[model samples]
Each structure stands twice: as C-alpha cells, then as structure tokens.
Target chain A: MLSIVKRILGQMKNDKRSLGLLLFAPLLVLTLLFFILSDSSYVPKLAVYDMSEKFVAELENHATVSEETEKPEAADYLEDNEIDALIWSDSAGTHIELLEKNSKSAVALEAIQDTNKALQPTQKELIIDYVYESTGDNQLDSLSFVFLGVISFFFVFILSGMSFVRERFGQTLERMLMTPIRRIDVIGGYTLGYGLLAAVQSVVIILYAVYVLQLQVEGSVALCTLVMILMAFSAVSVGALVSIFANNELQLVQFIPVIIIPQIFFSGLIPIDTIPFGLGNLCYLTPIYYGCTALEMIMIQGKGVVEIWPWLAGSVVFIGVLFLANVTALKKYRRL
Target chain B: MKIEVCEVNKSFKQQQVLNQISLTIAGGRIFCLLGASGSGKTTLLRIMMGAIPADGGSVTVGGIAVPNRQLLAEMGYMPQNEALYEELSAWENLKFFAGLQRQSRKTFAADAEALLEIVDMAACKNKLIRDCSGGMKKRISLAVALIHKPKLLVLDEPTVGVDPVLRRKIWLYLRQLRNEGTTIVVTTHVMDEVTQCDDAALLRNGHIIARDTVKNLIAQTPDGNIEELFFIDNQSEAEAPLC
Candidate 1:
C-alpha cells in the first residue's frame, strides 16, 4: 500500500495537468461564483407611481427609485425590465408589479418590504427564527460550504477516476497486480494517496472559502475540513470503483452523468422533499450528500462534530464499502 | 524454480482461449512461446503468471501452486502492452515496482542503474514514459521487469517495438540472466527472435503445433526456413512474413 502510495505521489508530482486540475479548478469556479452570487453589488431599479413621499424616500435608500406620473407607463417599464418592479397605490392596498424571469425580482421585493416596514414603524416586525438559519449575507455565501464539498469531491472524483482508467488502459494496473502486492493494497494505496492530497486540498479550499472568499463558518473550520477530507477519500474509492466498469477515459467520463450528476442534484442543492415521490431518499446513497449536509451543519448551522458524526460516518461507510467493492472488482484482472 | 503448466484450460464466455495446454520450463534457460495473434500466447502467459485462473489443470512455480503471493515475489512479468506509469520517469517507475518487490532503496538505486544500462536507457532514465518513443518505452518496461532480478522472468512480446540493435542487446541480457540461473519465458510472433531462445514452442489456434530446440526445428523444415513449417498448408490465413 505504501509503495502504491509512493507511486501515486511520484506520478502526481510529474503530472502537472492533473495537479492543476485537482487543486485550482475548484478554486477558479468558486471565485467566479463568489462574484456572481454576492448580491451586494446589484442595485435594483424601482418605479413608483402615486406612492407617499415618506415611503418613496425610504425605498430610495434601498433602490434607485424613479418617479412616474402614469401607472400604465410604470407597469410598461417593469414589463420591459427597464425597472425591476413598479409600485402604486389603489383602493386595495399597494400594488407592486415585478418583472418575471429576472433574478433582480427577489432583491426588489426584499428592498420594498424592508422600506415599508421601516416607514410604518408600528407595523409589527416579524421576528421569525429558524431551527437552522442562514448566516451568509447572500445565497452563495451559505451555498459556498456545500460547493466546497461538492467541488472538491467533483474534481477529485474526476482525477482519481481518469487516473485509474489510464492505469487500466495503459496496462499498468496489470503490471502492478503481477507483483506480489495484495489487491486490497492497491485500493488502500489509492485511497491514502489521493486522500492525502484531498486533505491538503480541503485545507487550502476551506481556508480559501472561509478566509479568502469570506464564506461564513459558524462552526469549527477544522470540522468542516475533516468532513471534506472524508468526502474526498470517498470520492477516491468511488472513482476507482466506478472505473472498474469503464474501459477507457471516455467511458469514465460517460459515468459522470450516471454517478456524479445525481449526487450533485441530491446534495441539498435542490430541496430533497420538494422532489417527486421518495426519490429524495437517493441522497442517502450519495457520499456528497452526506458531505454537503455535514458541511452545511458546520458552516451554516454552527453545529459541531458531535452533531455531524453520523454524516461523517456516512462518508466513512461509503469509503469502506467502495474500497471492498474495488478490491473485489479486481478479480476480473487477477485473483489473489 | 521449475515452472510447470499441466493440462490448463481457459475460456471466455462461449469461446475457448486455451485448451488442454501444458508446458514445462526449467530454471536457468530461455524458453520462447511462438504464435500468431489470437493464438492464445498471451492467455497462456497470463495463466502461468497466475493473472487469470485456468478452468482445469494446474500451474506450479517450483513446488508452490499458482496465485501464491509469496511465490510471485520471486517472479517478474512484462505484459505485451507497455504497462508502465507514463506520468513518471523511467527511474521513478522502476523505483515503484522495485519497492513493491521489497527491494531496499539502497540496493534498488544500484540495481536500477545497471538494469537501465542493460536496456540501453541509462541516459533517458529521468525521461517520462509518455515522452519517450515507443522503442524507449519498451526498453524501460524491460528494465522494470528486471529491476528486482527475479528467479523467473516472464516477458510477453518484449521485442515488438524495439529496434534491431537494442533487440540484440536485450536478448544478450536475457541470456546473461539465464546464465545467472534466471528462468525466462518469452512469447513472441517474430520467428528470428525464437533463435535467441534455447527452446521454442509453436502454437497454432489453441494447440502447440511443435516444440523443439531452434536448430532442430529449423533442421526439420525444408530450405532451413522456419516460415515453411507454419505454411505447410495454403489454406492458412495470410500472416505477417516470418523470416
């Protein structure tokens, strides 16, 4: 196992492309998402017609408020997306027409509601609290924890899968098996090798997400990093296990849809209960789901290791099962 | 160790690959298995290496049954394909396999250098296998198999992509290893390469058509042409020219 680990590290040392893909690819995507997901830079355009001066003044602080003489014209502006939303008062409360399909609609609605609450003063402020509340300033800030788990697992999965496929196709696997090394050693060695790099990768990425990208972490950052490292080990084992069914790199890639995409979908990206039927239960089977769930508990809910050990155990069980499966799969190549 | 394969049988799905095949190879000699493509040469080699199980019969290296991990420690094998770590340099690849064979790092450092020299790849020892030419990769792979100086060396089509000059050098190295009591089994379709071996087995379909010493086999064929032995019937498919 140590020899295989040494070989993996040696190969990785010489493979600049794989190293670059494994280390920097997730960072690049997250950085791009950092800029795109943060809503602080966006200023919503609001068109007001027949609204009181006090409410418009408060709304002005939250948005770029435009005054209009005609309600139809303001509605037309919202239709054309010239304004994110239009506000007017009639007999039945105040009407706010928001442009559909524009992401700016939610921002506009939140700004209007805040402005209304501020101006009314006595209109009771709803102090609703959740069991687990989002602490991020924006959606991405909260989702960044999940991204850290998903992205790290994604890249590691691809790297390990492609590398294993290369070994099989290049026949290096056959050569390795020809040695006196136990089949389990090959699986263990890969897990350790890639798992070591995954630990480093998790540290760098979690630190980058927490310190560099300023992703809010309410719980211990070390706990989150541990979860990510486990996810990566699971990714390595899963990748090797998946590669057994693949004949080439392209076939390995073809598995991404079947093996990876489902995991991403079920990794709490889309609300599981919202999914039709009991398909959401499939999330329990994906390693990334447990990883993302554990990371969410740590970074967002401020939950510690005690609260998340089951999730971590889920990843551990994944690694163990897949490791055995990989060992058994090698029976097709060499038995013993 | 004396390698023995007794009445081995192997099949894939409905198609049979090896059928009632048996052969004995004594230690300290170069034995060659000669056959055309798909003639079960690779399958036979794989079964001998304990890579794949035989449906019937048995293979034993020395006195131990096949697939014994400790027994494999005394054997080195080179598959037909260049099964090497392309991302690693030749030296690094050697170090990895040598480490698996449990060769101490200090001893491997010297043994690797000498093996690289034998394969005439000392200068390119640090070159990555992917960057090396086909012939260079073959030489490095050959070096990798010899890195541990195993008691039994199994090579499958080791000289396919190697240049003639380097081929002669590798043959000489095998003979030298044989003299040092290494049992070597090589499989190749190349007829002239058979002359380098002490004994040759001609496999047709899944059966051994002939097995004899190089001189005796050549003496049996008319015109001293080994190709004539394989071409006794015109109905045989067109084959790569055999010298």
Candidate 2:
C-alpha cells in the first residue's frame, strides 16, 4: 500500500498537467465565481431637480445625489450614462426617469422609494431580522461555502476517476492484483495518496477564497478546512467505487450526470426545506450535502465542531462505506 | 515447488471454459501450455495464479492452496497484454512492482539493472512506457515479472511481437532461471518454442489432449512436426497412455 502511494505520487509528479489541474482548476473557477456571484456595492447616481434640501439630503443616504440646475440637462445626463436616474417634482406629482433599462435602474428606483419613505414622518420604521444574523454579504458567503464543497468534490472526482479508469484500461490493476498485496490495501493506498492531494487542493481553495477573495468565514478556517478535506476524501472514495462499474474513461464520464450532478442539486442549490414534495430529504443520500451543510454551519452560522459533529460524522461514514465498496468491487478481478 | 491441479472446472455465464481439468507441474522446470485462442489456456493459467476462482476442485503450489495471498509472494505473473504504467519510465515501473513484492532497496538497484540487462531494456530504462515501442513494452513487462526473483514465474505469450534474436535470448534466460530452481509456467502457440520446455500440455476445447516430455510428445506424431499433433483428426494418438 505504501508503494502504491509512492507510485501514484510519482506519476503525479511526472504529469505536470494533472497536477496543475488538481491544484489550480478549483481556484480558477472559484475566482470566477467570486467575480460573478459576489455582489458589488452599486450606489446609484441620481440627478434631482426642483427638490427640497431636506429630501435631497435623505436621498443622499440611499444614492449619490447630484443637483441638476437645468431641467433640459436631465436628458444629457441620462443619455451620457452619467446619471442612473433623474428625479423631479411638479404640481402633478413626483416623477423619476430612469436612464438604462437594467438592474442599475432598478436600484435607482429603490433608492428613490427609500427616500420617499424617509420623508413620511407618520410611517413606522420596519425592522427585519434574520435568525442566522445575515449581513449584506451573507448570500454570497453562503453560496461560496456550497461552491467550496461542490467544486473541490467535482475536480477531485473527475481526476481520480479518470486516473483509475486508465489504470484498468492499461491493465495495471490486473497486474497489481497478481502480487501479494491485499485488495483493501489497494483501495486504502489510493485513498491515502489521492486523498492527500485532495486535502491540499481543499486547503489551497479555502485559503484563496478566504484570504485572497475575502470570503467571510465566521468560524475557524481550520475547522472549515477539515470539513472540506473530509469532503475531498469522500470524492476520492466514491470516484474509485464508481470507476469499478465503468469499463473506460468515457463510461466513467457518463457517471458524472448520474452520480455527480445530482449531488450538486442537493448541495444547497435549492433550499432543502423549500424543495416541493419532500424531496429535500434526498439531501441525506448525497455525500456533498453533508459537506455543504457542515461548511454552512461553520462559515456562515459560526457553529463550532461540537454543534456540527453529526455532519462531519456523516461525511466520515459516507467515505467509509464507499471505501469498503471499492474494496469489494475488486472481487470481480481477483477472488482473493 | 510443485503445482497440482485436480478436477478444476470454470465457466463464464454458462459458457464452459474449463472442464474437469487436472495436471501436475514439477518444480525447477519449464512447463508450457499449448493451445489455440479461446481453448481455456488463459483461463487455466488464471486459475493457477489464483486470479479467478475454479468452479470445482483445487490447485496447490508447494502444499499451499490456490488463491492464497502468501503464496503470491513467491510467484510472478506477466499477463498477455503489456500491463505497465505508461506514464512511468521502465525503471520506475520495475521499482514499483518490485516494491510491492518487498524487494529491499539495498539490492533492488543491482537486481533491476541485471533484469533490464537480461531483457535488453537497459538502454530504455529511463524511457516512459508510452514512448517505448510495442516490443520494448513487452520486454519491460518481462523484466518486471522477473524483478522480485520469485520462486514461480507465470508468463502468457511473452514472446509475441518480439524479434527472433531477442526471442532466443529470452528463451535462454528462462532456461537459466529454470536451472536456478525457478518453477516456470508458460502459455504460447509457438510450436518450436514448446520444444524448449521440459514438459508440454496441449489443450483443445478446455481439455488437455496430451501431456508429456517434449521429446516424447514430438516422437508420438508420424513426423517430427509437433504442429501435426494439433491438426490430427483424432487427437487420441498423441495422448500419453495412463500409468
């Protein structure tokens, strides 16, 4: 088993491309996700004309209010894209003209509405609270936790799955079986070797997400990394087990839709409790669900290992079951 | 170490591969199993290696039962296909398999170099298996099987696609190993190569039609051509009479 680990790591050292993919693929995707999913603080620039100083001051809290001395200049500002919207009041009522028909325009309109509410002294202020104490970045922070679990699981699964399938195709598995090595050692060696790589991958991704991309984690980074490492091990074990049924690399790829994509759905894509028809219960069956849930607890909800041990325990159990399945699957090749 | 197979039966999906097959192979000799493709030669070899379970009966090597893990420590196998890590160099592949057999690093370097020299793969030791030619891969596979210096060596078609000169060299090396008390089992369709074996067995439709010393088996046919025995209408003429 130790020899197997040495050989696998040696092969990895030789193949620079796979090593690069293993370490950097998730980081690249996460960086892209950081850019795409992260919300930017977009403060709409509003051009107000014929508005009271007090009302304009209130609008400044919600938007960047710009005073317009000429009503005709409103068209110039809106056309030039310098202002998101133009607000003016007359004898009819207040009117707001939006520049572009996009999300920025909607933000400007929301700012205007907020300003109007502030002006109404008779209305009571509304206070909305979250059970988990969410800030403005909560949505992206929570989504990053899911991606942290899902993306690391995905790259490890495909790489390790393909590597094992190639081993079968090359007949090395058969050759290895002819030796005195036990079947369990083969699975264990592969897990330890590939699992080591996966652990490094998880650490790099988590560090890049937290320190570089500024992903806010309420709990200890070490604890979140532990969950991610467990998640990565599950991927390696499950990849090996699944490759047993695949005759070739293409056949292994076919399993992504069957085995991997469904896990993504259960990995916090849709709110588990909100999925119609009690399908949320299916999350327990997918390995990624436990990882994502545990990460959510640690990174978002600030829960410690004491509160999240069940999810961690669940991940360990899932990895153990799949590792045993991989060992049993070797029976098809060698009875011993 | 001697190998004994008795009444071994194996089938795949109701398709009978081996039926009540029995044989004995003495130690320190080269024993060849001769057959056409799909004649259960590979299956019988696999059964002997404990790679697949026999449906009935048993096989034993040196008093140890078949499929025994400890027994494998003393055995080496070279599959028909060149089963090698394509991404690794020939030397790395040798080290990996040698490591599995627990060959100590103190002597492995010399042993690996000598095996590579014997197989004429010393020049390509640093070349990756994928970059090597088909024949080079075969030679490396042979070297790997010989790396651990096992007591028993099983090779299936080890000479196919090899040049005649190298083939002669390999056969000479096998005889040398045999003389060194290594029990060798080989399966091949090469008629001339069978003459190099101390004993030979011919299988047709999962049954051994003849088993005898190469000299006696050749003399049984009308002419000296051993291939004639395979093409004979009634194979009973070539079968050795039971003691």
* lDDT (C-alpha, whole model) for all candidates: 0.86, 0.90
- TM-scores, all candidates, are 0.90, 0.86
Write the residue-wise lDDT of candidate 1 on A239-290 in tens digits.
8889988988999999999998898887778988999989999898899999
Query: Taking chain A by itself, what TM-score does each prediction score?
Result: 0.89, 0.81
Best model per TM-score: 1
What is the overall TM-score of model 1 with all chains considered together? Answer: 0.90
What tens digits encode model 2's per-residue C-alpha lDDT throughout B139-224? 99999999999999999999998999999999999999999999999999989899889999998888888888889989988988
Q: Which window of 10 residues has the lowest lDDT sum in candidate 2 chain A?
A: A133-142
Tens-digit lDDT string for candidate 1 (B1-243): 787888888888878887777777777889999889999999999889898899998999997899888888899989888898888899999999998888888888889988988889999899999899988998998888888889999999999889888899889889988999999999998888888999877888877777777789889888887766777764332222221
- Candidate 1's displacement at residue A289, Å, is 2.7
Q: For each candidate, report its DockQ versus the true two-chain complex.
A: 0.75, 0.66
